[model samples]
Target: MSYARIGKGRNLPEQLEDDLRKAIVSGELAEGQALPTEPDLAQRYGVSRSVVRDAVRLLIAKGLVEIRRGKGTFVRAARGEAFAEALLLALARNGGTALDIEEFYGLLLPGIAALSAERASSGDRDRMLLRAEAYLEAFGREALDPSSDGPGLLRALFEAFMNEILKACDNKLVELVGGLLVRMRSFRDLAPEEGAREGGVAAIIELEERAIMGLARAVAGGKASEARAFAVRLCELRPSLRARLASTPAGDMPKLSFDMLAPIVQDS
Candidate 1:
């Protein structure tokens, strides 16, 4: 693994944590492998053992490393999954509304689309198309054909599709936040106004699916600006989404299921 001299912007511990995190994120530190001993790290980094300990503690909190009582500290799961789990716990304890979360997406998703446009590999784009196709098929079957699947399943499909787009974006930090949003399933229960339901739930699903597919294509084609625009226009089509955001009190957001926040093991 390549190493760089610690930068001056942050304090020693923060700098230490950032360097360590980069290594972990870059796959220099393999998952479940023990980290270097504190004494060894201190010597390598030219810092005191206390600073190494503090840095390791920070890594522990960030979910990049885990400590066993008898065994040494080891790399945890994927950094992004760890970050998502930590954010989920924070939301559960601090409390926030679904709309508040939507507003966050307004800020988050466009950038994700733009990034995906710029960074997505051919394989990444293919995965997105596959997910979009899956969403369309599922929704079409439920709407056009008789099925036992509930609206909740369609909601899951929507979240899964969005999650795929996020993964395609290839920004780990953004992916972490996107994972939290996908699992924030409470808003799935937020119903539209009576008039909005006139076209029926199938209509909503169809419209959303079309827009999502278009957005995916835009990203796949490497049209960064177009991808961003498609995302904004999608929200315009679903005023209720923005309405739900407006109506939700930030602190009153529902607590998501802890089971949903479990860390996923990421293969480096």
Candidate 2:
């Protein structure tokens, strides 16, 4: 295993933490790889074991490493766990409302789509299109049964599709902020808006299937402008989002927990 060159600086522990974090994030310390023993790290960095322990503690807090009982500390694949935690804290502190989230998306998601169009590899594009296709197949099966969990299924599918796009975008910031999509699903379930039409759940599913297909095609075709435009069009279909965006509520908003947001399966 390669060790970072330690230079004299501020707090030795903090500098050690920075060095380790950079190594982990840069793939030098690969995921699941065992970190050097505390003694080895201390000797390598010319620091005391206590300083090494402090640095390891910081890495643990950041989700960069996992300490196993009787096993050594191992590097973790940093998959936005820290970002999600930070965003949740920020949202809670700032009184994040549904409209606030939607507005953020209005600015963020289209850009994400455009970036996906520009940067996505062929495999990434194929995977995105495949997710849309899978959604259609799942929706088709669900549509035949009046008692099916159409809305719930669609929510899952939509989230999955968007996640694929986020991955395709190949941007760390986009991937981090993309976590809001999960919270947005929770917000949508908060008040439970009616299906977009009288034709009921199946109709709603059909419309969403079409919209997602259009989005997939634009993204896969590598048309950045069209992909972004399609994302805007998809956002317009959410009546609840529109309503939330139009008015800001007064006083402290009710706290929303993603845990309580159950999938809405209604009988037609």
Candidate 3:
């Protein structure tokens, strides 16, 4: 029995916790549904009632379930706002530096882009193209002015790319990573005008447009390999872009530093 596996001097509480967590996430125990009574669960799992209680406590600690006094334990809603806040807090605690965030991006974004390129639908392609066009327009206007909406535009484009991945990856782990990337990106304070001034905003915009178009065309044409390669190349350019931004002057925008932004940008 599953509960017996926990009780045989084998760290039963932890094992039960894992099992119950999986069951909740997989919908074996539906959201808001009460868990079986401690005695019932204990009997079902071949464990003591105390072990079952310990498992419930563990799940509650993880925010996977809620216990009502004299009621029972109930599954929590999936991706609840409270859960998001807790997850972000946990990430922030673990993420001590910008480099840590960058390392995370470095690991995930390219793969997400590749998968997006491989699986995006026509609507996704159109949405990405529209965002790319908007980015180009923002770049052109912000090239001359120090105060350009370049970062905001770039964020929108990032979302366009990310939405494709979230829709196609069909993996919760990937989705969670993508969400973290977005959160990190939100905290990124890049001097886009400086990068535009130094590297020619028009040229950067063209590169971004090309990347978006490349992925769109590849996915639409069912060219998965080409899509994957395009994504890899795009990811490879991010490091160079960060290097360029780091070297560029901040002009009037304080002594804005890229070091702080590097980790978030570099996160895989």
Candidate 4:
């Protein structure tokens, strides 16, 4: 099939890539469908084979298509990993910090929790409970053996527990954003301080763990309001993780924006 000839432009490869991307997004192209071969695409677009190859490469990097050896290129059902990686790269380039991600997630977690409560399946609830229980076991082991892998287990469990909750929310867009948030986590916050100073960081983390357990139970019991309450409490209690971030040098990344949240995190 002939595509409209791309007009002369600032960058031929980029323009071609954009046009192809639009076709993919708008479903002019479809998942698992073969794309025109390079020579054919080059002829159709009135571009060189090299330009077609470059455009296809860009689409591949974006996770839109895969080139099969001899079989040809096919539109892919993008899993969002490449997109997530690009977003995170942009965020880091713009000096996005752990605190920035935390605050952003803070704004969303309560709502996510409420939605999960309303929609989570029994399996989701069961998995969440398991993750919560595993974290507690890791926490106890960490206390007893400082050098054990328990700390690492704690971090993994933390991410897994959040992943489970995000999945339970049953919204693919939310799950993607939440997955980014999970990755954006420095894991430095295996602890938070907001109102947790009185209880101490470790104490606060344990309390939050119990709340997670409670949340899973609430979801199982079909209590959306209770789930949101647990999330809000966890949100209000997580500022301590920011304490460590505060003292850490900004290093090469530009230091801007996060200072505004500094006072709020400190006040918490």
> What's model 4's TM-score?
0.71
Q: Superposing every Cα of model 1 onto the true structure, what RMSD results?
A: 9.1
All candidates' TM-scores?
Answer: 0.59, 0.71, 0.54, 0.71
- Candidate 3 yields a Cα-based lDDT of 0.60
Every candidate's CA RMSD: 9.1, 6.3, 7.7, 6.4
- Alpha-carbon runs more than 4 Å astray in model 4: 7-11, 26-36, 66-77, 150-153, 188-208, 237-240, 247-268
Off-target runs (Cα >4 Å) in candidate 3 are 1-19, 32-57, 66-74, 77-115, 123-157, 169-188, 192-199, 237-268
Native-referenced Cα lDDT, model 2: 0.69
Where does candidate 1 have its weakest 10-residue lDDT segment? 259-268
Put down candidate 3 lDDT per residue, 1-268, tens digits, no spaces.
Answer: 2344455556987888888887887888899998878888888787788888888888877788898878877888876445556655675565434444545665676666667666667776676566556654554464445465645665565566555556665567777667655555443245543444454544544555576566656655656677666656554524554544344332112222222222222211
- In candidate 3, residue 147 scores what lDDT? 63
Estimate, for each residue in 1-268, the C-alpha lDDT of model 2 and write its tens digit.
3466565768888889988888898898899999999999999988899999999999998889999889999998867676666765676577765566656776787888888988889988898998899867765565444335545665577677788889888877777678555545344222223222344555556565666787898898899998898777665524444454445432223233221222222321
lDDT of 4 by residue, 1-268 (tens): 2387886746888888998999998888988999888898998899999999999999999999998888999999967878777877776677766556666777898898889888888898888888878866775555434447634566687788888889998899998888877666544232221222432445434554566677667766668898787666555522444654444332222122211221212211
RMSD of 3: 7.7
lDDT of 1 by residue, 1-268 (tens): 2335554667888878888888888888989989888888877787788888998999987778999988999998774666666666676576655566666776777888888889888988888888878767766665543244655776677677787778877777677777777666344432222233333555555565667777889988899998998776654413434455455555344332211111121210
